[model samples]
Target chain A: MRGLGTRTVLYQQNVAASLGLYNNDLKSVDILRETGPITAGELSKITGLATGSVTALIDRLEKVGYVRRANDPNDRRRVILVPEYEYKEEVGNTYRPLHQSMHELASSYTDEDLDLITQFIGKASAILEEQIKQLNVKKSKSSS
Target chain B: MRGLGTRTVLYQQNVAASLGLYNNDLKSVDILRETGPITAGELSKITGLATGSVTALIDRLEKVGYVRRANDPNDRRRVILVPEYEYKEEVGNTYRPLHQSMHELASSYTDEDLDLITQFIGKASAILEEQIKQLNVKKSKSSS
Candidate 1:
């Protein structure tokens, strides 16, 4: 299981390198794609990047046309990020092979077994997320 | 599954932050732990980092006492990395809570189910590694 996690990290870093972006930058984009439009502050919170760093990250991403920063209609002073559809498609292509292979792997399992696996993975991910939050909280406290 | 992967990445990024290490540095350590005493060149190849960057990486890890650089027994001029056992234990401690939680989660499953899940994850990791290699190959080709 730890081997699986290490491989996932390596895979993500390689993907980020392939796209000429930092691993964290790609990770931010990953979050944005799932989250739709969100404030820079929200992105910072989610990604564990500081506000200033998040601004730079958004600039670099915007410069590459992978993301857009637009004014929040309800709060004109605020800006929100949106992952460009084209950017998502282009990056999604790079993942196609892996997804295809995984899909095939899934096909070999019974639906009952798949449900069991899904439940296990979902619970495990929740555990990981809780741990990540705690680590970030600790990081902020130490830095301050 | 993708959600699990994303959380894993975020969890690892936070872990790296908590330890004052780059995510890649921690990742390199993870690989070194698995591979054991490998040459700097071998570590560079395994981690997809340039030789110069690998040198710097070794310097940093050595400075922190997480790794030691020594001449290879068979080739006195070549430096190899040996992950200090103390370093491993310290870093591994940071992951113990997650491990404990995962172990508890696993305890709920039958051995046959656990075997199936392990096989799936192993295969998925292989597919991911293959894709990572291809991306790295493409990156090098383009850079050259």
Candidate 2:
């Protein structure tokens, strides 16, 4: 599991480096992609970064044409982030090879087998998430 | 896959923060744990870090008592890194809960199912490694 985790991080690091973007930039963009337009505060909560850091993150992404900040529709004082579709499409092209390979691999597994794999993965993720929460508590306690 | 990858990175990050160690320090210690004693140059190659950065990384870990620098027995000028067993064992305690959970989860799967899962993970890791190599080439080209 640790080996797999290390490889997973290295893979993401390479992906970010290959695109000439910092890891946080990619992570922020990915969050925006998945959640759609959201407030800067919301992004900070999800990413565990400070609001100032999220603002800087958004600024960098906007500079690269990957994201933009817009005023909230309901509140004039509010601002939200939006992902630029065209820019993300271009970035998506870089990951096409990886997706294609994974899809091919998935095709070999029968639906039943895939179901079992998915179940296992879901349980594993839950375990990791729980552990992360516990670790965060430990982190906060030590810092305090 | 991306979600798991993100969680894996987050877990490592939290682990580092909880222990008051930097990310690279844990990474260097981890490399030593996995590969036994290795030269600083080999560590740099495996981690995609510059030689100078790797030297600094080793220095930091050595100061933490997690790793130590020693002379390579085969060559007078060469140096190797060894993980301090006691320090790593103490660190390992933090991960003991996680290892126990995973072990329990694995116990639920049949041997055949476990074999299938292992095969898939191995194949997926190879695919990612290949993509990383290709991405590195692209990164270098663009930078140069």
Candidate 3:
């Protein structure tokens, strides 16, 4: 489990380096890509980055053409940060080999094996999300 | 799988925030703890951080009492970084509940189920590592 976690991080670090971006920046791009257009404030809240820091992150991403900022259609006062979905091609290509390998590995397992694996992973992921939520609540409380 | 990866990153980020350290700094401590006493240069090599950046990282970690720097006895010119393993208590306590929960989750499964899960995780981790190595190689080549 520990090895899996460490390698997961190392993989992102390498990918970030190859793209000439900080790990946080690359991660922000990912979040944007996953969530579609969202306000900078929402991004700050989700990422736990301060207002200034989140702005800087957006600036970096925008400069690289990975993201764009536009006015919210319903609210003139709000700015929506848009992910340039096309940017995924570069990042996706880098991950293709690992995806292929993982796909091959899963195909080799029986249905029962996959079901068990999926159950474990699903439970484990929930536990992680729970812990993260608890920590975030604690942090916000303390900061408040 | 992607949720697991993102959550893993968030878990570490929250832990780092709670510990008053950068995510990268906390991860550096993890590596130092795992690898034992290693020189700054060795850390630089392992993390792919520039020497000056790593020096700053060591300084931040040392300031917070999570790391110590010592001169190698056999080679006076080398400075060895020793993690204050005692610091793990604070970090460990935060993770203890999750660890306990995961232990229970695992114990609920049969040995066969555990075996299959382990095998799958091991193979997936290797693929991630292999992809990381390829990225690192590609990065170094481009930089050179």
Q: Candidate 1: where are CA atoms >4 Å away?
A: A73-77, A85-89, B74-78, B85-89
lDDT for residue A51 in candidate 2, whole number 0-100: 78
Q: Which ten residues in a row have the lowest lDDT in candidate 2 chain A?
A: A85-94
Q: After superposition, how far is residue B103 of candidate 3 from its true place, in Å?
A: 2.6
| Model 1 per-residue lDDT tens digits across residues B33-82 | 88889998888877788999988988888888778988889999887899
Q: Is candidate 2 or candidate 3 better by TM-score?
A: 2
Cα TM-score of candidate 1: 0.93
lDDT value, residue A102 of candidate 2 = 86
Task: Please provide, for model 3 over B45-97, each residue's C-alpha lDDT reduced to its tens digit, 9 standing for 90 to 100.
Answer: 76767789899999999988889999988899988999995566788887787
The lDDT of model 3 is 0.83
Better of 1 and 3 by DockQ: 1
User: What is candidate 3's CA lDDT for residue B138?
Assistant: 81
Residues A1-144 of candidate 1: C-alpha lDDT, one tens digit per residue: 888898899888888887778988888888888888999999988878789999999999999888999988989898889888355665888788788888998999999989888888898988998888888888888889
iRMS per model, in Å, is 1.0, 1.7, 1.5
Clashes of each: 0, 0, 0
lDDT (Cα, tens digit) per residue for candidate 3, span A52-90: 999998898889888999998989898999888465678
Q: Indicate which candidate wins on DockQ.
A: 1
Which model is ahead, 1 or 2, in terms of lDDT?
A: 1
